[model samples]
Target chain A: MIEILKQGWHTTIQDLGRLGSQSFGVPISGAMDLNAFQWANKLLNNNSSAACLEMTSKGPELKFHEPSFIAFTGAIMQAFLNSKPVKMYKPIEVKKGDVLKFSSVTLGCRTYMAILGGFQSEKVLGCRSQYKGVTLEDRIVKENLLLFNRNAFTQKGARVKTKTTDYKDVNLKVYQGPEYHLLNSHSQNEFKTKQFTISPSNNRMGYRLNEKILQQLPEIWTAPTLPGTVQLTPDGTLIILMRDAQVTGGYSRILQLSDNALNLLAQKSTKDVIKFELITL
Target chain B: MNNKLPFTFFRMHPKVILLEWEQDPSTETLKELTHFKANILKYSMGVSQITLGYCSLLVQWKEDIINYSDAKKNLIALYSNLSINSTPAKTKHWTLPVCYEGEFALDLAHLSSELKLSKDTIIELHSKTIYTVYFIGFLPGFLYLDGLDSKLFFPRKKNPRLVIPKGAVAIGGKQTGIYPNESPGGWHIIGNTPISLFNTKNETPCFAKSGDTLSFYAVDEAEYQKIQCVNNPKAYLTKVK
Candidate 1:
């Protein structure tokens, strides 16, 4: 068991998310950064879809009850164990009662923490994701205890390094949506040329970017939308749907992030400047 | 004006295509499209998933069996010679029981004031109307229902509640819906339904599906408890066809 000593802004347990339930009004809730999540799991040699911890801006301080191997990925945050500096990307073995803490990050938005054996929790809709203040009633907080398999984690100590040398820039690839032609040429040019900042109004549902992409579109009927769909609401704001987005929407979709780009957007921090690259193929 | 509709196919990506629709997915058209998609799925083994919405069908494909050109040609042929004959369809109509008193309805008085209708009139009008399930979205088991009386059109709350209880019957803008689970919502709560709109344990999580007809019934507080307290609660009775 591991105990939460300090709760950060928001932290939740997430897996590969629920599938085949979109038509039934279910959002696929999984790790925001698939690369980091999978990498963390690979370090532990666990299943790809094993549940991991997802943390935002501020991260939690935890105390391990049993010695275990853990890996932290995504965001270049300052991490420590028992007041000593530790690595970020590689797996680390902690003795029982060792305290792990994370400070604010200088880059990226969200970070992921993975245990060797995965977290144990009641699976809802075949997933263990905790949607704060949304689906389930409780959220992980200070003094909370989490149970896991001890034997499974100790089989092989991880050889991953703490420093992640391969951090990719947030350059998203997008394709024209159904209403792309509705935008005027000048507005479309501006959308491709200008850089947009990640806004604070971001969650698992959608990320509202600080950009003027929506100002270009002519009036049209509401259309069906999906995750990764970049919608331009009437106010010229860009709202990119995330994991828990609605199955359909009313706003005009000016651009849609590709399957690979959606994973990158999940790790973006507030105020990070990003440019969109049009997908040619 | 001639009613003839031409089928157009647009490339969404290498894996998907958008089937343009001249008309919205109505009850009849939805059935036809559903059958058409089923037909394609049966004959074309390469299709991965087909997502049907109000106005379009996003057909995703597997690259192993069919290429993009061949799949598009097959779809065009299927649409051009679409059989217009009616086929046997499954229809379900349900009567859901609702409670309109006390904490069960947080925004009843506010909704009454905004629409200029008394609380009783609001409840009566809301419960009496027959609604159709358009598409389920937003949250698990959440229904985007159509057929709310236009006179009762009201905007969503300026600031949505962080947690709205499950089974809350609410309205927003021109649409009406039920919060199947505890979720944050901006809809104006008119009443509470004892019925479970969604249950993962149930064989079919969502009690209602696209093309299902629903009618709401007003029940007093005592009846609400009686309906809610029982194990395997029966809040809505359905007529299966």
Candidate 2:
């Protein structure tokens, strides 16, 4: 068991996410950065679907109750165990009552921490990822206890240097969505030329990009949408649906990000400039 | 039935394939979608999911696609050749209860005055028609039901409510639906249902499927209370033969 001394912002227990339920209108509320989440699990030799704690901006301060292996990934945050400095991307051992603390950093927007056996959070609709309506609580609150297999951590794994994701890169590769042709010719060209900044109105659901794509085209009949779908609203706001995005939408789906691009975009904070590099399927 | 399987396919993502129809939302489009979905699920090699929509289907494959054209070609061929529709044409019809009295009818009076219809008449029109569940979105179990009477068709609120209570049944443009859970909604609330539309404990969270048909029946405040306390609201759900 891990006891949370201080809760992190938008902290939630997430795995790869809930799939096969989108047919019933459930959002795939998974980790924002899949590469990092999967890497953290890989470092601990845990199952890929093992639940990990995902936090945005600030991370949590927790007290470990048993000897276990853990890993931190995504953001290059300054983390400490018993006030001793710990490095990211490396699996570290923690004894009973060892306090782990994380300091806020501006380098990345989201972070993932994986335990030895994975978090045993409540699973709903075949996922451990927390969301409103589906789960009893949406976030990991302060003083809450997280369940995990005590003392099940194996031998310390070799430190892995990150390679899958480039956090600093803002150029996200995208594909033309189902309704991409709906955009006027001039507006369609704007994606290649214009650099969109992440707006303040961003969350787990979506990232509302700065600047209007166009005076929105007519609404399409409600269609199935996915994470990384860039929707154009009536007012012309270009919002990129994230992992927590709804399954269906009525807005014009103008562009779609590849799974890798979506993971890259997750690291960006508000006001970060990004360019859409259109790629042929 | 859509002859020759009228659909335009697209490689939307590395793992996602989109099959879209040109027509507007209709029972015919739904029938075709339902038929194709059932077949795709049966023949899934790595197809993870096939999500339903008004006029399209988003098919997601578990593995990344090495050849988009080949996958699209195969799906097109599969739909065109499968003529024997194993899926039953007749859909399950349900009659759900709603209470339009007091606070449950948040926008009833305003909608009545705006549409130039009495409150009772408005309720009559809403409850009379059987609505098609085009898809569920916005919130979990929030059905995107079509078939609102032209008379009750009103635009969504200019300013959406901060919090719309769960079970709030409302109309927004040509659509009418019940909110399965509490959410911030812009639709005009005409009534509320005490019976839960979604429960996580059940194997199937929402009883209403995409192809299913449903209608609302007005219930009194007393009856709403009696039905609200029960653990399983499915017991109260009436099946229309």
Candidate 3:
């Protein structure tokens, strides 16, 4: 068992999200950075879809009640074990009563923490991802107790090394969306040239770009939307839907990020600048 | 019926394909979409999720598990052979109770004045109509209901409320829906329901699904309280043919 001493900013337990539930209007609330999420689990030889704590900007102070093997991945948040600094992208053994904490994020926006086996929580709609309205609790709070399987810690594990990337000013590759041709030639050129900053309104649902497209696009009847779908609002704002985005939308879908680009964009913080590059399938 | 249905098929994501029909929202279109969705679920492989919209359907699969080209070919072949003469699936009907007094009906007076109808008449008109659940979107379990009374049609509020309470029955741009959960919305709230429309603990989280029918009946404060006091408000729901 692990107890949260201090709940960090926007910490939630997530897996690969609830599949087959979009038809019911449930958002796929999974890890923002899939690469990091997978790495964290891989380091501990845990299941790829193991539930992990996804921390945004800040991270929680946790005290382990039992000895466990853990790993931290994604944005390089300064993590420490019992006041001694720990490294990212590798497995570390923790004794009982050891406290784990993280300092302010240095590079990226989100971080993931994975334990041997995984955290156990109530499965709502065949998934443990904490989505508001779908789950009893939307996020981790102070004093929250997370339970893990004891059998997972009994087996010996080796430390695994992984590569980390700098997310600063990354170029996101995107495919033309269904309504990509709606933009005039000049607007299309501007879209490819403009460097848009991530707005403060960014969340698990979507990141609203700071710059506008300055294109006139008529609204169609509501259409299907998915994670990584870039939609142009009537007011010209370009919003990139993320993991927890709604299943359907009414805005014009102008671009869709590649899977790798989606993971890279998830690590970007507010005010981080990114350029979109068109890619062919 | 025309044998050839016009549609544009494209990949939204590497694992997600979209089939968009060149048609508007109507009973026939919905019926066709329903049939298509049923066929895909029955015949497709590795399909993780399927989402339907007014005129489009998005099918998502597990990456690398199924051949995309083969899946697309199968979908096209299945669609071509589909018979439109078959009857669409039967829709279930639910009669929900709504209380339209005090805080529950914040925009009632304004709506009554704007539409040039008495508040009682507005309520009567709303209660009399049978609404079809077009699709669930905007929020979880939020039923995008169609068949709103043309007389009660009103534009959305210029300024949206930061927090519209759950179970708030609202109208926005010719559609009426009940908020399954609290969310920011621009719709005018005319009433509030005592029953929970989306309960995650239930086998099927959402009470009403797409193609389901719903009707609202006005209830006074006392009856509203009585329903709320029930052990399971969902138990009070009557499913009719």
Candidate 4:
């Protein structure tokens, strides 16, 4: 068992997410960066869908009740074990009563921490990803106790390194959306030329862009939406739906990020400048 | 039924295929969509999730296991042979009780004045018709109900409210629905229901699904509170058809 001493900005237990539930209006709430999430599990030799703690901006201070093997990945969150600095992208052994604390985030917007086996959380609708309506609690709070297998075998801890990219500025590749043709020629050109910054009002639901393209189009019927879908509002705001976005929407879907782009964009913070690049399959 | 399938298929993602029908929302098109969805689910292989919308369906599969070209070909062939006249699967019916008094019905009086109808007349018109559950979206258990009385049609608010209370029966444009949870919305609230539309503990979280029928009946505050205390699902849900 691990007890949270101080909760971070937005900490939640997430797995690969709840699949086969979008038809019922459930959002696929999971780790923002799939690449990093996979790496955390891979380092610990855990299952790909093992539930891990996802921390945003910063991470919680946790005290382990029993000895355990843990790994940290995604967005260097200046983590330390018992006041000693720990390296990212590698598994570390923690003894009982050891406290792990994460300070200011030096890079990336989210981080993932994986245990040897996985965290044991109540599964709602075939997944353990924490969403408000589906899960008992939306996010981790102070004094929350997370239970895990205490007797799970840990592999020999190895110091491994992986190449990390700087997500400060990125070019997100996207495919044309269903309503891409609705935009006039000039507006389409502007969409590709203008660099949009991530607005401060970003969340797991979506990332609202700072720039707006005032192009008018006929209202469309509410249609199916997914993560990485870029919707254009009437006010011209370009919102990129993220992992926890709704299954359907009414706005014009103008662009959809590629899977690689979605993973890269998840590491970006507010005010990060990004340009949309159109790609053909 | 239309003999020609009026759908345009495209790849939304590497592993996601979207089939969008050109027809507008109508009973005929909805039924056709329902048939198509059922057939696709029955025939398709390696499908991970299938989501239905107002006029489209998104089929997602595992990219590593299913080739996009092969899946697209199979789906197109399946669509061509789909029979719309076949009987659909059984649909559930739910009769919900709503209270339209005091704080629950924030816009009932305003809507009554704007539509030039008495509050009682508005309530009577809304409760008389049976609504079809189009698709659940936007929020969990948030049913996009169809069959609103044309007389009750009202435009959505220009400025959306920051927080609309849960179970607030609302109207916007030509549609009526009940908010399953408290969130920001632009719909005009006319009533509130005490029964929870969504419960995570249940095997299926949503009470009603697509193609289900729902009818709202007017209830006083006393009755609403009485029904709220009943936790049994079998007690509240009754099949009319």
* The best candidate in terms of DockQ: 2
Q: Quote the positional error of residue A34 for candidate 2 in Å.
A: 0.1
| lDDT of candidate 4 over A1-281, digit per residue (tens) | 99889998889998998888887899988888888898888888888999999999889999999999998988879889999999888888999999999997888889999998899988999898999777889988775699888877756864446766566657899999889989999999987898989999898889999999989766678899989999999889999999999999999999989988998899997889899999965
lDDT of 1 at A1: 92
Q: Clash pairs of candidate 3? A: none
The alpha-carbon deviation from the true structure for residue B233 of candidate 1, after best TM-score superposition, in angstroms, is: 6.4
TM-score-better candidate, 1 vs 2: 2
lDDT of 4 by residue, B1-241 (tens): 5636578877777778888989788766676677778887787777788888888898887663346677777877877777642556667778888898888999999999999999999889998889998899999989988899999999999999999998899999999999988889999999999988788878788878888888889999998888889845445566744
A133-206, model 1: which lDDT tens digit per residue? 23453357665686677887444655654344234565788888878888888888977888899898888889
- Please give, for residues A1-281, the per-residue lDDT of candidate 2 as tens digits: 88899896668899999998887778999899999999999888888999998978888889988778888888777888999989888888889999998888658788899998999988899999999999888999875799999846566555666675667898999999988997888998899899999999989999998888765599888888999999999899999999999999989999999888999998997899999999987
Better of 2 and 3 by DockQ: 2
User: DockQ scores for all the models shown?
Assistant: 0.49, 0.85, 0.81, 0.80
lDDT of 4 at B76: 78
Which residue pairs clash within candidate 2?
A: none
Task: Indicate the TM-score of model 3.
Answer: 0.96
Badly placed stretches (over 4 Å) of model 3 are A154-157, B1-3, B64-69, B84-87, B231-241
DockQ score for model 2: 0.85
What value does the interface RMSD of model 1 take? 2.7
